[model samples]
Target chain A: AQSVTQLDSHVSVSEGTPVLLRCNYSSSYSPSLFWYVQHPNKGLQLLLKYTSAATLVKGINGFEAEFKKSETSFHLTKPSAHMSDAAEYFCVVIHTGTTSKLTFGTGTRLQVTL
Target chain B: GAGVSQSPSNKVTEKGKDVELRCDPISGHTALYWYRQSLGQGLEFLIYFQGNSAPDKSGLPSDRFSAERTGGSVSTLTIQRTQQEDSAVYLCASSVRTSRDNEQFFGPGTRLTVL
Candidate 1:
């Protein structure tokens, strides 16, 4: 079975500073990785995804993630943290073959402060 | 075009009651999924339905939880004898279910509260 692990349960960063949220995965077959953000009372929005074509993936809201196969990691990063970035982030993974199920991480609550 | 939509955005029911949550997937989408999000559990896969194929319900927590999708367009998730632990957000998503990729369009989700 495939699974995802979010190393941090919560992360706090000052406005204008860089932000990072770590994610790792374990899948029996090749996997599709994704980052989704959820704001209060809002539906989950896909930030980015890695389908093995590119190691570095750029997402919406100026967020990005790099897929490191050697380390089994897909850590999300941003050059600058904005207050609007405060929300819950989830790391998701799908099995290699098509028509697969998705496995979500525990979730990381991001808090951006001034 | 309208995105995925769910009914009863907010539901409040007493314990031991049964509740039905509805989802209307995007037009022409062949794949649909149901997931539950709790306070700490993030998102838990509940079921998957594609076309007229049998749904994959391996993620269902218990027999009390069941779901059905008709005409490959709409779905309803039913919870019998709801409990406090059943209080959470139910999310529905639709996709093309292609063999090469699956990009799901998600709904706002139905927030259920069992008091």
Candidate 2:
């Protein structure tokens, strides 16, 4: 079985400050990891993904994540926070098995302040 | 290109009633998926369909939940004897065929509330 754990349920960052959202995953086989952002009353949008091709993955809106196999973690980061970045973020994992269903984490609500 | 489409953006029904949620995938995408999102449960996978292959229902919570995809395009998820706990946002997504790296495009969800 595969599962994703988000370290924070909520994070507040002032505009122009750095943003960080932590996540850890567990999977029996090789896994594909992803970060998705959801604005209020909107559908989820993929930020980035890591499928073992690269350790560092860059995404839209100046966001990125690093996959660390040894630590079993994939944490999202941003150099400068923006008001538009306030939203809900989910950490997801898909096992290498044939079924190929995505398992989502509890999600972290980011609050960007001025 | 049009994103995934889901009908009846909101629904409210009484317990014991049956409800059906609809989904129309992207023009050429062959894979569709259904999920439930609630305040308590977050997001839970409900079903998946790839082309004409049989769907994966491993995530359906119980016997009262069922779904079907026809002609490899449109899909519907039906809930029988709806319970209050069934209240949640139902989400649908579609991808370009079956690829490990394929990203899914989601539809604005249907928020269902069972009284």
Could you say which candidate leads in DockQ?
Answer: 2
Q: Return the TM-score for each candidate structure.
A: 0.95, 0.98
| Residue-level lDDT tens digits of model 1 in B5-78 | 99999999999999999999989999888989997777988998989988988889989999999877899999
The positional error of residue B54 in candidate 1, measured at the CA in angstroms, is: 0.5
C-alpha local distance difference test of each model = 0.90, 0.92
Across residues A60-89, which tens digit of lDDT does each residue of candidate 2 receive? 999999999899999999999999999999
How far residue A81's Cα lies from its native spot in candidate 1, in Å, is 1.1
lDDT accuracy of residue B64 in candidate 1? 94
Measured by TM-score, how close is model 2 to the native structure? 0.98
Say which candidate scores most in lDDT: 2
